[model samples]
Target: MSAKTKYTDEPIGPVKVIPDFLPPPEELVFKEDTVKVTIALSRESVEFFKREARKHDTQYQKMIRRLLDAYAVAHSKAKQNEITAKRPARRR
Candidate 1:
């Protein structure tokens, strides 16, 4: 049997009060506008995602979705920049 911890009344020196760094309950839950689509993918791509998802301990479909979302966001930003760069400067 293990020995019980002894009770002590000694004050802990230099206690620091830490602020709450956690997000609120509403923010904690992520809600995204998603739509279901039926599409076919190459066997090799699906297999690759599945293998990676197994190694990372996450769902394969989720990994694929995140990858597509990131790709879309990156391309959207790039397209916006391209358009802005192509525009002529306005004269005062």
Candidate 2:
């Protein structure tokens, strides 16, 4: 075992204000109504989410819900785009 090393006093550089380039956090939120339903899953599947949830410190049910929500949103957008593509373009 070695003793802790001592450090000489060092000065920090002056701080400069940087422009904020990220979007506001509020923009990311959209409330959605939810319904509760009972469902069954394989032990392996539940275990996987539970393990992942533990690592991230969140409920497995919430993670599963978000995954389903994202899937539905993506598929809905793709379907909308496909339908739009099939319609004739309007004259300017």
Candidate 3:
């Protein structure tokens, strides 16, 4: 038997679900240097980011850029360490 059937014999009626929509305010203009990026994500994660971005009054792309920059710095440091480790030991 399915888990739903095991848990409850009756069907659950209309669970109040929240709609995922953001109404942008008027007079919003993006700068010329700004570039648009489309990232593929699961529906839930996208909604989470959208909510967080709305809370901060900043675009999701800006938040993603900041995160990417931090990730890049850490990744570069790890790569540098790996390169250094591969070098042969020098004798005096």
Candidate 4:
């Protein structure tokens, strides 16, 4: 940053309208149903997630939960595709 930078107080041109590229407010409010359960994790795994979560400024538990959710979604899609491919085609 320079101390001698020039700045102007002139009025700007008319604002251009841009299309909104965001989901609706109602649609954005997603409430995830969660269950509390006790489980044991390895020391190394816990440490790894904790470090990464600290770097990202988020809770370690949330990071772990999102990771598991992504993995489940990937496997679920693969299983669905495999089943679809194995099914015989219908005749008209």
Best by TM-score: 4
lDDT of 3 by residue, 2-58 (tens): 656356578888899865333245523544255677778788876877889999998
Candidate 4 residue spans exceeding 4 A from truth = 1-29
TM-score of each: 0.64, 0.66, 0.49, 0.68
lDDT of each: 0.85, 0.84, 0.71, 0.83
How do the residues 1-92 of candidate 1 rate in per-residue lDDT, one tens digit apiece?
Answer: 99999989998799889754444679537976889999899999999999999999999998888778767877797899999999999899
Give the per-residue lDDT digits (tens) of candidate 2, residues 1-92: 99999887897679899754433578458665889999998999999999999999999998898788767877797899999999999999
Q: Write the per-residue lDDT of candidate 4 for residues 1-92, one digit (tens) a residue.
A: 76897789987889999754444579548977888878899999999999999999999998887778767867797899999999999899
Better of 1 and 2 by lDDT: 1
Off by more than 4 A, model 2: 1-24, 27-31
Considering summed lDDT, which 10 consecutive residues are worst modelled in model 4? 19-28
lDDT for 91 in candidate 4 is 95
In model 3, what are the clashing residue pairs, if there are any?
none
Candidate 1 Cα outliers beyond 4 Å, as residue runs: 1-29
Ranking by lDDT: 1, 2, 4, 3
Query: Which pairs of residues collide in candidate 4?
Result: none
